[model samples]
Target: MYVAVKGGERAIDNAHAWLAEERRGAPDVVELSVEQIREQLAIAVNRVMAEGSLYDPDLAALAIKQARGDMIEAVFLMRAYRTTLPRFGTTFPVDTGQMRCVRRVSATFKDLPGGQILGPTFDYTHRLLDFKLAAEGDVTLAPEATEAAPEVPHVTEFLNSEGLIEEECRTDAEPPDLTREPLETPASRALRLQTLTRGDEGFLLSMAYSTQRGYGRNHAFVGELRIGVVSVEMDIPELGFSIAIGEIELTECETVNQFKGSKTEPPQFTRGYGLVFGQSERKSISMALVDRALRWKELGEDDSGAPAQDEEFVLYHADNVQATGFLEHIKLPHYVDFQSELELVRKLRREVAAKDEVT
Candidate 1:
C-alpha cells in the first residue's frame, strides 16, 4: 500500500473526518436512517443498485448515505464493496413472463393479455411539488384491488405468432460476465445486454435520444415495459431440484424496431431488449433503444456512422465507475507532474527569447 508523504496522511484523515461531520448535517435535524433511504428515496437506491450491479437495497442505501447522495460516488462505493463478496452459485434465468407485475404497459397495443397496469406510477402527476408533504410527510394509503391480478403474456408473443417479429430462442451457451471478464470487441448480445444493464443511465439515455432524433433512426415502438418481482431459483446439488432463493424486482423493456429483410430471408420486425434491477422505466427504455442502435450490423442494416452504432465507444465509456475514476484522478495530487511541465515551459520561453535577441 502507498503511504502519503509530507503531512498528507494527517490532511487526508482530517478531510475524511470533516466529510463525515458534513454528512451528518446539523445536529438539530434528525439523522436519516438507512431504512428511510431504502424506503423513501427508493428511486435513488434503485439507481445505485442497477449501476452498481448489486441487488441489495440496504447496501445501496448505505452507500448513498456514505456518499452524501452523490450518485456516482455511491455507485463507486457499491462496486468497490461488491468486489469483496465471495462467489456464490449462479441462479437460473428468471422467467419474466411469470412476473408478479406491479406496473405493465404496452405502447404497441391498446390492450394486451395482461391488460395495462399503471401501478404506483408518476406519469399522471403534475410537475408541481406538494407542500403538504414537506409539512405533514404523510399520504393516505392506496385502495386495494378487489380482483386478483391476471396472468400476462409477453407483447412480442403476439407479433411472433403472426410471423412478423423475429423469434428469440433459448440457448445453453454460457454468457460472458462483464464483471469477471475483460470486455472484448464484437461482443455477443448476452455480453452487450449485461453491459447495458449496468451501464450509466444518462449516457445510454443520451445515445438513445440521438437515435430518435435521426442519428441512426430505427423507428422503435415500445412493445412492452414491465416492472415486477420474479422468483430467483438455484439448483441444489444435494436436493436434486431447483428451489427459490429469493425475489428481485426488475424492469424489462422490449422494443420493436424497423424490420430487416434480405434476399434470402423474408422481412421480420427486429427487437431490442432491456432488463435492469428495480423499477427504472426510463433506464430500461433507453437501454432498449441503444441496444437496437448497436445491433445495426447484426440485424443486417447499414451503419449510418452514429455514435450509438459504435459498439466500442458505447461499451468502453458506458461504465460510470471507470469513467468517474479516470476523470477524478486528475483532481488528486499532481504537483510533481505540474512542476515538470512548468519548468519545461519556462525553459522553452527563455530559449525562444534568447534566439529572438540573437536574430
Candidate 2:
C-alpha cells in the first residue's frame, strides 16, 4: 500500500504532461486555433454552450480545444469555469417575435406570412461528400439577396385566431433557477423546461424518438422552427429601465399536438415550446416533443408510463455532467474497496469448503 502511494504525485504530473502532448498532436501539423473552432465548429460550440449552461462562445471554443473535441468533457470544463464567475442580474424574457431570423420554416404551412425563407439549411443538399472541401481552396462567395427576409409570424397565431389552439396560461411569478435551487420531484413546468434546456442532446433525442415510435405518442407537428439572434435586456435599478446587454443566437421550436377535448373545454390543439441557445434545430425539436410528453398529466390525459413522462427519471438523468462524473469516477482509485470485496469472496469460499468436508 505504501509503495502504491509512493511516486503518485510524480506519476500524476507525468501523466498530465503526456496528456498535454497528446492534445497538441504531431508537431508537423498546424495547431487548431480557438477562433477556428468557434467559427467552423459552431455546432459543437453551440451544443457545449447549451449543455454547459454558459453562453460564451469563446470560452466554449477554448474548452473544446482543451478537451480535444470531446463535447461532454468540454461541457464539464465550461461548467467548472462558469461556477467561478459572479452572477450580475437576470435578463428580461426575450421577445422572439422581433427576432432577426436567418432561418424560419413551418411544416404546417408552405406559404405562410414569412414566405418560407430557406436560409442556410442543408435540407435540400445532396448527402454526397464534396471532394473540394477535402483540400483548402479559394471558394466563391454566396450571392447576396436583393432584399431582407419578410417578418415571420408564429404559426400558432393562426390557430389561436381561429380558436383552434389552447391559449397559454400566463403567470407573474418568477421562474425558479435550477442551478441555484435543488431539483425537486414533480417539478413545475418552468423548472422542467429549464432542466430540459440543459439536458444532454443525445438523451433528449432518444427520449423524443421513443415517443415518435409510440412509447407516448402525442401526434406532434412542427408549427414553426426559427433560428435567429435576439437581444438580452436587463433592468437597471439605478436607471429604472431595462437596457440591452448583448445579443444571442437562439433556435425556437413550437410543436402543435392533437388533444382530445375535456368535458369543460372544447377540443383544441395543445402546444409544446422549446427555446435553446444557438442554432440547434434538432435539440430544439427533441426538447419540444419531450416537453409535450411530460405535460400529459397537466393536459388531463392519462400517463402512458413512458420514460419521458417520468418527471423524476428524466430530470435526474438528463444532466450529462452529473451522469458522466458518477460513471467516470469508478475508473479512479478503488483499491481499498476492491480489496475488501476480494477478501469477502475468499472467506465465503473457505467457509463453503469447510462445510463440505464436515458433511
Question: How many clashes in each candidate?
Answer: 0, 0
**How well does candidate 2 match the true structure in TM-score terms?**
0.96
lDDT of 1 by residue, 1-359 (tens): 11356777787789889999999999999999999999999999999999999999999999999999999999999999999999879999999999888888899999787789888789999999988898966677778863425558999999999989987856999888888998998999899988998999999999999999999988999999998889999999999999998999999999998776866557888899999999899999999999989988877788899999999999999999999989988987787899999999999999999999999
Against the reference, the lDDT scores of all candidates come to 0.91, 0.90
Q: What is candidate 2's lDDT per residue for 1-359, written digit by digit as tens?
A: 22377898788888899999999999999999999999989999999999999999999999999999999999999999988999988899998887878888888988788667677777899999989987888776669853435456788999999999999878989989888888998899999999999999999999999999998888999999998888899999999999999999999999999999776668989999898999899999999999999998888888899898888999899999999999988988889999999999999999999999999
TM-score of 1: 0.96
lDDT of 2: 0.90
Q: What local lDDT does model 1 show for residue 353?
A: 100
